[model samples]
Every structure is written in structure tokens, then in C-alpha cells.
Target: MPGARLTHEDRGRIAAWLADGLGYAEIGRRLGRPTSTISREVARNGAPVAYLADDAQQAAGHRARRRKPRPSATTSDGQPTEVVRGFVDEFATLLAATGLPRMTARVFVCLLTADAAGLTAAELVRRLQVSPASVSKSIGYLEAMALAVRQPAPGGRRERYRIDDDVWLRAWQADTGAHREIAVAAQRGIKIFGAGTTAGTRLGRMGQFFARLSEQMGGSTLAEPVGYDALTVLAALVHAGRPLTLDTLATALDWPRDRLTAALDAIQLHPAIADPLVLRTTEPETYTITTRPDRLGPAQRQALEDPGHVR
Candidate 1:
């Protein structure tokens, strides 16, 4: 019975046991199921105080229907089913645990597993069985986070939601930037509270941690699998062995001034997380980068190599 699912009758028994003020173990013993199964069911449905037999049964039925294999998603048994549906479902749940909203994670995972052709809003609605508004919310969240990119369909009439091949990289960048922002907030706290106080000490440590992470990630651009345009600018800086002014760097690269500026802005943010890989000073407005990630430990080196390190 450890692997058995609870039936409506079993749910009734649980409700009765709950009414009797019995614990989760006693309820599971009476139902011929493991205590963890009972606990999981109640936790998934609602908290113990508000648990209802009917509600739990209904929720269970709903989940089973959701897990039903569709023609498009065939299981290994050769039955028509949703391929990797359980993986995506469980992955979304895991992301939710990491602070991604349940619906947003579901939407992200949906687009992630969908074909390279991507899915339009209507298609998402039909597949997820959610409303247009829900699709909008989920897509909006992902777009804001730079995880999902929306493109016009071939007909140019509808927009398709797609998780790009660079989704993990973009997600990593965005998550790491969030840490930098958190560190900035901690720095602000230090200013608000006296630096000598306990609160100030905690804030100082918080800022240092995030700043170190940011630095390590920033330096990762030099590691293997580093081909992004921004890193090209850094490579140039490292080769020069001396700080180059923005105007000079732009002139040498034959890149637009705005492009150089944007690249520098992105690079400078890394200093908050760790040692400044790219340093820009107002006194001369020059840029400097020295390749040093090779000297870092394996953990630090891997963090640079992994695009999803922060997330």
C-alpha cells in the first residue's frame, strides 16, 4: 500500500481522522498507506485545518487527468501521451521552489519543450488549458526576465512564444544581475544603519557575498565556450595589457560608440560581485580588463562556465 493512491473512501477516512484530531501517521495506518503519502496529499491540496475530503478527492482526480497521456505525448509503453510531460511538470515544480511562480514556471517549461517552431498564444491556451490572460501573464513574466522571446508568426498576424537556445545563458545573466541589485540594496542598508551596529555588519556580509558572486560570474566570460560579443571587447582589453579609453577602444574595434558604451555598462556591473574584471573611472573614462579567471579554483571556474549558475 506504500505506492497506492488515496481513493475517495480513503479521503473520507482521512477527513474523519482529522476530525478525530489524529496525527498523519495514525490516518495513514488506518488507510493502509504510508504516512508520507497521506502527508503529501494533504499538503498538495491544502493545509490540515482546511482539508476537506471532497476537495482532496477532486484535486486528486484533476491531477490524474492532467497526467493523462495525450496523442502528442506518448509514454515509453507506446501509448499516446505527452512526451517528457512528467519531467516538465516536475521541473516547473522545482523552479517554483526556487521562487518562480507555479504558472510562470509551467509556461516557461511548456515553451522550453515545445518545438523550435514555437507556440502562439492560442496554441498555448489550447495546450495548457488556461485562459488567454494567463498566457499573457506568464509570457510577460518570462519576457521581463529575458527567458522567453516572442516573435511574429510566419503570417505576421500572431506572436509566438519561444525559449531561445540562449535561454539558459540569458537566465543566468539575469539571475546574477539580481544578486548584484540585492548587494546594492544591502549597501544602502549599511548607509541607513550605523556601520558599527549589528545590522550594519549583517548588511556588509550580504553585500560582500553577492559582489563576490557577481565578480566570479563576470570573469567567466574569459572561460571556454565564451564567444559572446561583449566578451570580444573584453578579450581586446586583456590583449592590450593596458587600460584603453572608450573612444580608443571603439576606434580600434570599429564599433559604434553606443555599442561600446553598452558593453562597458554591462561589464562594469560585475565589480559588485567580485574583483572588477573591467574597470572604468570617470577621471579618465578608460576601460581595463586583465584575464585572471584561469587562476580561480574549480568551483569558481565552473561557475563561470555554467550559464545557469545563479539560478
Candidate 2:
């Protein structure tokens, strides 16, 4: 029932319903159709005030007659048929409606539905019937967003653009990265606008919302919450190249002692960083990063302690 075409009787009922001042939702409810279906029907077949069932039915017939007939057989190289091409265009239009650039959406869809080997720019250009420049620009945009990647075509200078199996995962990660950036920028705005001011309060709420969203989407999957402050502390420690006392870190970072302590605690708790690189507590309450000994074999550790023994 969902995908079934609207019958002539259905169109006549829609016209009568409109005349009776029934909204799309009520009309859809009575007809057991989706609200969007009713809305699109009315929009394309002349709007509510001007809608006539006879005229709308006639237009629908004309449009169907103009549509290309699908072939019963496949092409020589197993390329997409006319019907599949039509579907590609329709799907691309839906993707574009969701904020992706039109050309980019088309290119992305083309790559998505392509063979596992993928498609070269020339192939994409020929398939989409667009200029080389349009294909090139769209591929660049897709690559930048991690939605597509380029692999070398066998025995040729041409590179194939492919939608990886993990493309959606990469895209989700990129979106979460954008959310974190927005949260950070909003936090900065709060500082600039004065914490007690109306603007600052607005920014504070916005910052908190994005921050929570980012943590919910990105942080939960990770070993621990590695936020901006923790990252800043890690960067400072990495740059310092030696152990540093808490007072020294406070002075170098210009952060409150409690804030620095919290960041250090987070860094220590984060297993992703802790495995390859460890957060160490040195003498006199100093902190430093070192290789996690558990990651290395005993011989490897000994070799590092006495490099001459390796030979």
C-alpha cells in the first residue's frame, strides 16, 4: 500500500477532501496514506486551491508516457540499465535534499552503487553525463569528507574512486568531529561574550548541548572520555619532553590547579593512550609520559636499556 500509485478514485477523494478544508494529515489518515504522499500529490498535481482530479490524472498519464521504458536485458559490460539510472537520480535527489551538495550527492551515489572495483573519473563522467570538472570537484569533496577514497587502477595512471565498506562509519566519525569543534567554538564564544551576559548564557547552553551530543556519540565508544582539556594536557606533556611537577604544569598551561588535576586523571584513565604511551608519576609529584612496559617483550625492553647487547 505504501508504494502503490494513487488511483483516479484516490485523486478524486483528495480533491473533495481539499474542498472540504481537510489538511494533508487528515486526508492521509482517511486514505491510509503517508502525509508526505498526500503533500507531494497535491504539490505536483496543482496546489490545493487549484487542484482538479481530472487535470491531475491527465498530467500523470502524460508524465508516465514520457518516462523511458526499461530494457528486459542487461548491457554488455553489466552496467546500470535505464531503470537503475532513474533510481540513481531519484536517490541522489533525496540525498541532496538532506544538505549534501547536488553534484557531490550524485557522485557519491554513483560510487556507492558501483562495482567493488570502483570507477575512474572518466567512467563517472561518462556515466553521469557531466563535465570532467564537475566530477573532479565532487570527488574532491567526497574525499575530503571521508565518504570516498581513491585507489590506483591496475596498470594505469587513472585512479578509481570507491565507497569503502566503512564509509558510513567514517562519515559518522567526521560528523562527531564537527560536533566537537562546534562545542569548542561555542565554549570560546562564552568566554569572549562575558559569562554573566545574556549572549554568554546562550553560548553556554549551546556549548553544553553540542558537548553532550559529542560525548554521547563519540566518547561512549572510546576507552575513556578524552575531552579538550585532557588533550591539551597531553599535548603540553608531550611538548615538555620531560617530567613536570603539577605546579610547573599549572604555570606552563596557565590553568587552575584543579582543572589540570582533572585532565591528568582523565589522561591516566584513558586506556587507548595508556597502552602505547603511559602516564607516569615521577618523584616529587611530577608527571611524564613513557613507553608502557607491558607492551614490549622482556628482550625488547632489555635491548632498549642496553642497545649494544642486541648485536
Candidate 3:
């Protein structure tokens, strides 16, 4: 039984050991399997964070039963043979770290390693030797994540799945809206629970985090400024008693997102003009003016107007 496949119980022990934060060497000592075996098993299943003993064991069995002769795939170094297998294993492992299912990662790697035209479902099924259902499910999941795209086969009705240069970028862009939604929901929750309460306070903090995150997304894309909109926004915030969300500020001031942002940018650049302004407090991402009034001298205060009105 030197090279025998691992038993189900063995896998359970592996999972427990992993949960206990044991390294592969320690787990291998406990399981009496080579360290390489345990490492490869986890890599092909779902890496450490998402690995489930039962699922990994099942996948291992499926792969074992489906094993076939290797193709003429070459390594990145151009050596012929199955050296690309190791790269595929590593790629699948890293993909799982990003929250992709192991099966989905495997299927994605298969397409990535395919010819320029990509592969049909039938081809994926054949290449991975997984069930047609498995290929279909993986394709669907990748499609939903924007990590893969599907198109018609060149001369056939069958659809082909492929990943392109911007697959990851598109996936990141897709989540930017989700970040905006989270910030909005959290901001709304602040008033409902009353910011003085613990729940309201937590919501406010969360609102700030998501708001900053959403605003900083590269895909959010900043806009050019047009007029003295920033001055109006400052006046509105200074007049309002409590902190306000960007959305609320935009509506109350009747300024567009870009203009509001530009105004805030202007105020930030000239803190003396709006030295009392604070973007975050107990309520995150919400804007409020300081309760204490003007520390700025007449000259500094006069300079404030010049910076307050953004170009």
C-alpha cells in the first residue's frame, strides 16, 4: 500500500490538522503519507482555506478514475511533455485562493491552456475528464463572476468558453457597484438605529469603510469639474446640523456626483477655508462641520472663499 490512494478517514484527519494550523509536513507525519501527496491533494481540491475533506476525497476519486494518457502539452520553457501539468496545478491552487471553486478553477485553467479559439464544453469535458455536468456548472460559475466569456463555436452551434486578458479586471469592476451598494445601505442604517446606539455606531463605521472603498475603486473613475459647485456643497454641509451621506448631500445641494466630489476636493486642498469640515467621525463616510466655530483669522477666512469655489 506504499502508493495507495488516501482513505476518507485520512482526509478527515488532514482537514482537522489543517484547521488546527498544522503544516503539510506535520500533517504528512500524522497521515503517514508523503508530504508531496498531501500538498498535491489539497492543491487539486481547493487549497487550504476552502478545502473540505469529503469534497476533496470525492474529487480525487473522480480524477483517479478518469486518468488518461497526457497530451503533448509543454512547459512555459518550451520543453515538450506534461510539464504544464505542474503549472496547471499551481494555477488552480491560486485561483481557489481567490474564492473560485476547485472544479471551476480546473476548468478555467483548461481553457486558459487551450488554443486561441478556446474550448467547447465537450472539449473541456474531454480534456479534464470530468462529467459534462461538471464542465457546465464550472462554465456557468465563471460566467457569473465575469472571469470567463462564452461565444459560438467557429463553424458549429456549440458554445466555447474562454478567459481573456481583462477577465480579472472585469471581475473587479463588477464588484465596484456592490461596494457602492454596501456603503449606501450602511449609511441608511445609521439613522434607523440612531447613531448614539451601538448598532447605529457600528453601521456608521461600516458605511465609512465601504464608502471609502467604493470611492477609491479604479473603475469608479473621477470626473472633471465645471463650476463653483464645491462652495455650494460646503455651505450645505456647514448649514446641516448632522453628518450627511454623499447621496443626501448631492440631493440636498442639487449637485451631481462629480461636482460634489470636486467641491470636497477643493475644501480638502484648502483646509483653512473649511477647517471645521470633518469627513468622518462616529459616523463614517458622512460629512459634518465642527461644532466649534471659526479659529481662522480674517485673512485666512478670506482665502477660504477662493479655495471654496472649485473651478
Candidate 4:
């Protein structure tokens, strides 16, 4: 009951308390909630003077309904019922939101949720109630992304399209490959624009960001390269200017302990990062950033050793 959502009755009480000129802290104390919770509730529901119990309750109901998925229904023959169709459409809408073509998203969802044997083009057309051309075109798009594949149907000339077990893994790899290509193109732009120009500098940063992103995403097959997460951890340590324990890094980064641990491990192993800046384990689980003593190359070290040295 302590963490349960505030009810309509709670809203009524909040309205009454506000009308009586009660402060958020006082209201929260009476309601057994944190002051911040009470403040946010009141602020979102038109704050103190304008807040109404009935209006707030109705608005909250609408928000809750929108957050939840529609209830699913099934038919006796294992065919999708109207409710199922509606849910599929809703899911397709969400997929379309992520830059996918609407028809392609709809077709992909059908293949993803279909039976193991998969669906023929005619079956897909009937289920989706769309044109054959649309289904064919969408299937083409799905195939290009490695999200779906065509296989020969049993005892028939026609082919069936289905999502494979490794479809999502393949899709992820495809995305990472695309990122690598973009990074390469950006690097080309930097060379063409000349490194000293502002455009080249901007392209260089973009190239590095995409390259790092691609490396992070594709690092499962290769050696784990220093990624965005590891870089972020190093930045946090540098900014802190003091040793920070695992718990402190977790709290500051708002990341899980396991994720932070992985990033810290990556920072320790990356050779490129080992030269100029070292991630030192000062305490058992505490870390600090410090300069590496042998950071300079042989020539640079010699130059530093002898102040008057010249090439």
C-alpha cells in the first residue's frame, strides 16, 4: 500500500487540503507520501489554486489507459479475432513511428507473430486486408533489412515469408554496419573539406561518434573496444577530481552496478586510453584518473630530458 498509486479519494483529499491553504510538505505528511510526490501531483494536475479533484481523476484515468496495451482476444480456430487485428494495427503504428514505412511495419509484424510454418502472400493479403502489391513491396523491404526471409512452402510452388530465430540479431548487425558506413562517409567528408576548416572539424567529431557507436554495437564478435559508456565513466572520473567508489559512480551516472562494472573494466583494458590517462584503482573498488608516467614517446622523452635538444 505504501507504493500504490494515489486514488480518486486521495485526489479529493488533496483538493480539500489545497483549498485549506495547506503546503505540499504538510499535505504529503498527512497523506504518507514524499513532499516531491505531492508537489509533482499538484503541479501536473493544474497546481494548487486551479486543481480540481474530479478533473484530476479523469485526466489520470486517460493517462493510465493510454499507457497500457489493449486487451487481446482469440478465436476458436486459432485465427486472429477483431481485437487481435486491432492490437496488431496498434503495434504496427508503433513500429512505423521508428522511421519504418507503415506498410512495411504492418507486414513485418504479421510475419513476426505468425505460426512457425509462416504465411503465404495470399494469406498475408487476406489477414491484413491490403493490396498484393503492398504486401510484396513490404516483404521486399523486410528482406533487405534481414528481418524476414522467404522459404518454399510444403507441397506447394508458392513461397512463405517468416521471421527467423536470429532475425533480430541480424537486424541489429545490419544497423551497426550502416553506422560504420556512415562513419566512413563522414571521414571522407573531413578529408575533402580539409582538416583545418570548421566543416572538417565538425565532420571529424561526427565520424568519431558514429565510429565509436558502431564499434560498441558490433564489439560482441571482436575485442571490446573502448565505447561510449567507458568514455562517459572516464569523463565522470576526470570531472570528479577525486577517487570515486563503485557505489558513488553508480549513483552519479544513474546506471546499474553491473553496467558500471563493465565500463570500468573496459577502461582498464583499452590500450589507446592507457597512455595519456590511467584509470587507477586507488581502493578495492574505488577508482581515480591520473597521468601515466611513460606517456611520452621516445623522441618526446629525450626532448624533455634535454631542454636544448633540436632535430
Which model scores highest in lDDT? 4
lDDT of each: 0.73, 0.79, 0.70, 0.80
In order of listing, the candidates' clash counts read 10, 0, 1, 0
Model 4 worst lDDT window (10 residues): 217-226
Q: lDDT: which is higher, 2 or 3? A: 2
Please give the lDDT score for candidate 3. Answer: 0.70
- Regions more than 4 Å wrong, model 3: 1-81, 219-311
Pick by lDDT: 1 or 3, better one: 1
> What TM-score would every model get versus the actual structure?
0.52, 0.50, 0.50, 0.50
Collision pairs in model 4: none
Error of 2 at 2 (Å): 25
Q: What is the lDDT of residue 274 in candidate 1?
A: 23
Residue runs of model 2 more than 4 Å from their true location after superposition: 1-80, 223-311
Best by TM-score: 1
Error of 4 at 12 (Å): 38
Error of 3 at 260 (Å): 15
lDDT of 1 by residue, 1-311 (tens): 12235679878878888878999978765553446778888899788888899998898888989995754755334544344545565777788889887667777887887888888999776655555776798899989999999888997799888988988888788877888898899999999997999999999888988877866665565433322446767778778988888888999999888877766665565443224453546347687765444346689878878978856
lDDT of 4 by residue, 211-301 (tens): 7667556755334343678878989999999999999999999999999998887766552443367889988999999876444568887
On a 0 to 1 TM-score scale, where does candidate 4 land against the true structure? 0.50
Ranking by lDDT: 4, 2, 1, 3
lDDT value, candidate 1, whole model: 0.73
